[model samples]
Target: MRITNVAFAPGHAAFYFDDQAAIKAGAKQDGFMYRGQPDTLGFEAVRQGGEAVTILLQLENGLWAQGDCAAVQYSGAAGRDPLFTAEKFIPLLEQSLKPVLMGLDVATFRPNAMRFDQLDIAGAPLHTAVRYGVSQALLDASALASRRQKYEVICDEWGLPVNAHPLELFGQSGDDRYNAVDKMIMRGVAALPHGLINNIPQKLGRTGGKLSEYVTWLAQRIITQRSDVDYEPKLHIDVYGTIGNIFDNDVVKMADYLCDLEKRATPFELYIEGPGDAGSKDGQITLLGNLCVALKAKGSRVKIVADEWCNTLTDVVDFVDARCCDMVQIKTPDLGSIHNTVDAVLYCKKNGVEAYQGGTCNETDISARACLHAAFAARPDRVLVKPGMGFDEGMTIVANEMSRIMTTLKAKEAAHVDQPLQTV
Candidate 1:
């Protein structure tokens, strides 16, 4: 089959990550600066809706495969213009890459011929969102070409075992989806308000008090509650490097605070992500490693998850090689291609670093389902709930995909068991 026509359409996203953010200190269109970031993005106004663009590829085979692309509803906070990304990305595809991809054999489309993670179509670094959409379209076509599920294609290409089990997932609830409250009480899916960027005092709605206290109360509440599942709900928090806001980048103070937190949240461990971001990549790796080491020395079981500066497969390798954190959230979009994502997971496995196949609330259903194959093939420690942050939408997609794959495996096993005995 040959590529025939490439098209793009603008749409609206069903989910917005901006609601909870606007309730915090930064309420203006030009409010809140991510630490170490050069600009201030308007994260507040996106509550109305986020920009979504749908891509359709018409092929000579008379079949079509769809791709989804959307920036965070809070694009203003990132200092990006949504319309510009939409326009620039589609043409970049038509000009630099589409010429090569169009009319090419679907079976022979080499995905890594141009690596978006390292370069841009023009003179600038291409946004991961744009790269993500095209990469997904090609992946869908590849699966169609191979007569297999998209995830299976990656599994086969990387030589990952097909029968590996599904990855246990963690969810973070937002807006109208308040399952985190119930899920926590049931000791179900682990939830963090905003990973590291959330304001503990604000999210919990107390005028004055320490973040550690709220975390303690949260831990106490969850620990006291029993559940059918034996797993203790972890109090995972992503600081967005704002822990430094509380302590001014004092790693020693951060360690001391964690020690106190350990006292209250006993038996229930904490997975703290980006407690503080050191200004540079090396600084971050070293700082995170130092925190882990300090916690280890104190016999504190708190786990550190690296997020901010760890954007690509190379970053994953560096962080894992340096023993930066106990686990790495492999944000799938940043890889730009499924092949590199597979490589990142395998690298984490080879080096003994625990992995989490992570995606954002900004993704779509197609992308969400595609992630399931990776989660099962690699069996990462956790897979993030996706498509949207709403508990209903996200849980449905992730749970169904996991259930579908695992159920298929069981059916196959049962068929084998029922087979008549045969001579070897």
Candidate 2:
């Protein structure tokens, strides 16, 4: 089947926080509007407009998909806008990609051929964000055309297993680290408290001593609260490279404390990610080695997942090949396209390293659905999903669509397996 049409929904609607005020006024009882970032891609806040943006695509076959491209909604913007969100590139999807995608054979589209590497975003007329949008829209449209879930399309076309529970980087939470801990737990996530205490002094309203005591208290509370839940929650404390840079003296001591906490919370695996700043090549390798050594000394089998330090598939392959890390977190946007991310996961698997399909805090259902499919197709050891406890709209439809596509693909494979051999 060919794509007959591609369309985006109307622009984002204005949102008001009347409910928050009502709660403060005691007009509401059950829940209060706790201000946290809205779910979006990383760039929404920085865009000239202060509105959340959502892009919807409708295929000729009646298949529909929507993505939240607003940057600030998803990524908290710790640093500069990632390459995908460069200012000059945002308009192509809003204007160009869709028209180009119409009437293309969905099933036969070759994803690799559409790679954006050749697009001169930094030179000539093409813009980086625009090219990135083209790639993303194409992937979305292709998935719709094939009637395949985006993740399954990526896995079938590209060969990677899905990782269910991807790592989330938790930056400083307002004034209280405990608040961050509580937020994660309430969201049904086991967290890694990386960099929270390490940069306490620099953070607003926090002292080093208070931070250390809070970490100890939080660790103990987490361990004690284990039996209270139906399934034991996972917890990993991130040093976020603060160990080597600012808290060198406390690095080993903190590691020992976390190790002890892990023992007390036995059966719940803990992951230590980015023990030191890993922006540089040598730093990544050194941190990986140090993490492995510490875990070994503690006689713990908890995994070490590399995030910012392991940026690409090659980095993941090299780290796993050298037995440097236990897990690698792959972000779809960071990888550019779904196909590339899948390749990265496959590479990790080939080398016996676990791969986790991670999500940003601001991701909407479109991206989240894609992540779910990736996880389902890859079947990683653990998966991270935010359940719809209060929202009422869970990803049942998206999940069903993905499951159907996978079933169809499996049936096709079985039929091929049973077919008689033909002479070439």
Candidate 3:
């Protein structure tokens, strides 16, 4: 199918669900903004009002598809270039990308993507938002043209020979209460939370005296509060740079922190993200490698994930090669190219780095679902709940999508099983 025409407009997305947040990435008050206001940390503030880039594409035979480009408030802190703002995607779509995208077959989607990469470097490359939005809309159009789910398009493109098996994935919820956790469980998520790095005073505001005490309380709450706990859930924490700051950048203290974490976080699986964002890429890698080495020597099973300094596919490769972290969060939009994101996840699997395909809360539905499709194709260790401020919307979309795919596969299997034996 050919992409005939393209249109785009500005939209809005939430920074967080609740009022109280640690990092304070968005503005405190409402204001008139042509583009969204950037916060102290240079994150786009759409809390009161920030913009999202919503895209519409007209495909051949009068078919159409939509996509929204959402970037995080703290895009810079997340290792994303801050200039990739929400409104930044508009011109790139109209001026540069349109000519290249106008005519292509749905089946040639993968190869067409490579052409996009080649087109990108000639001029200022389309920002991740621009790339993600266009790619997503095309995926939608391709799926409509092919009569398959968007995730199926990705899976087929990846040449996954395996059946669509049901897999367990986590819920990205900020609810620290029993009721909220229960709700997440009922919604069909695999784990309690893909927790944000709210452990800092600016956000968490003294969750407890020490990190261990706070973790102990969280563990107790999960173990005691919910009676319907089906799986041995993991306790995931995004520490930002709080741990390193608290320990004064001392690896010994950092090692001690992990040691303490092993005690409270062991009974349940533990994942710690951004234990420190030590200055440069080298510093961050060193911090991660030191932590990993210390954890191994001390027999700590806690998974250290690289979040901040590892933005793109190249960064993922560097961190994996160094054995700096146990897991890498493939922040989807940062990679821009869907092909690169998929290849990064596959590379991680080959190199023994557990992959968590996660992204910011600053995304919208279209981009969020696209990331979910990638997660399904890659079969990563965990997937983030995204495309909305609150956990419910993203969680529901991802869970339902997975359920539908599995149901379809099961029905196909059942039909095959019941077929006549004489044919064999």
Candidate 4:
């Protein structure tokens, strides 16, 4: 099938975009908003409502494939793309990309996706968010044209085994660390509260006592609230480099603190994401590499996850090859094309590094669903809840999509198994 028309609509994402640099540089919280000016360019305030554009491709056979162009919450930080406002990008899509989409064949996906992903405008590629959404639409179109699922298309193209089973879901708590943890526990998420520990004073504490107490509380709370006695969820928290900042970026001191936190989270595994940001990709790798060695030397089980400065497929490869961290957050939106997310996950798993198929809360349901398909095909170690910070909303969207896909795949397999043999 071929794409007959291209249409788009400006829309809002499930969450807000926050200037990560501004927040890390001491932007005070002002009741769900930051009380300071934005440190990043293209941002008017420290926090603003996130926006997206829903791109719909009308196929010649009268089918519609949809995708949402959205960016991460911490836009314009850690070598990421600038903020993605629907109005700012809609014209580019219309003038530059819509014509290209109209003439393309939807019988395949990879080459079409790469065409848009690598399209150069004025000697530069399109914005990551634009490429991201465009690729999703192409993947969806390919699936619809072939009468197959998105995950099936990915697996078929990449020559990977189709993983019809559900992946482990990791939940993020935003700022509602305590209450959100309860919800995640009750829901039986394999990975518990992300615990946005970005700040040193408020969340991580001056001497790191506060985070220790919080981890202790989290462990106890899980034991108290879990209906299943054996539901031992791994405690994964994103510190955003607060531990490194508080400890003066000293690898030894950070290792000591991480060991302590691991003790507090006894009988449960702990993963700390972005433990430190060295402000540059090489610097981050060096710092995390040293910290990893230190943790191993100390016999600490706390796993470090690379986030900042690790934005692209190349970055994922570099970080994994360097052996800097135990797991890599293949942040889907930052990687631009959905295929990159898939490739990154497969790469991580192929190597010794674990892949966390992660995206942003400042996404939409469309992007989240696309991400889920990629995750299913790639078979990442765990997939994150996206499009929102609310524990329930993101969880429901991801869980339902996973359930539907698995149900359909199982039925299809059963039907194939029960079919009669042909006269071959």
Give the candidate number with the greatest TM-score: 4
Instruction: Give the candidate number with the greatest lDDT.
Output: 4
For the record, the alpha-carbon RMSD of candidate 1 to the native fold, in angstroms, is 5.1
Q: 3 or 4, which is superior by TM-score?
A: 4
lDDT of 3 by residue, 113-178 (tens): 655644654556666666666677767877878777676677778876434765566666552333
Arranged by TM-score, best first: 4, 3, 1, 2
Clashes of each: 12, 27, 5, 0
State the lDDT of candidate 2 residue by residue for 280-392, as single tens digits.
65567776667677767777676677765465456666777777778776654445444455567667767788776653333345555655555555554434332222111
Better of 1 and 3 by lDDT: 3
2 or 3, greater by lDDT: 3
Sorting all predicted structures by lDDT, with the top scorer first, yields 4, 3, 1, 2
Q: Flag the better candidate by TM-score, 2 or 3.
A: 3
Report the error of model 2 at residue 145, Å: 3.0
Candidate 1, position 179, lDDT? 42
Query: Looking at candidate 4, what is the lDDT of residue 299?
Result: 95
Model 4 whole-model lDDT (C-alpha atoms): 0.91
Looking at candidate 1, the ten consecutive residues that score lowest on lDDT are 31-40
Model 3 residue 405 lDDT score: 67
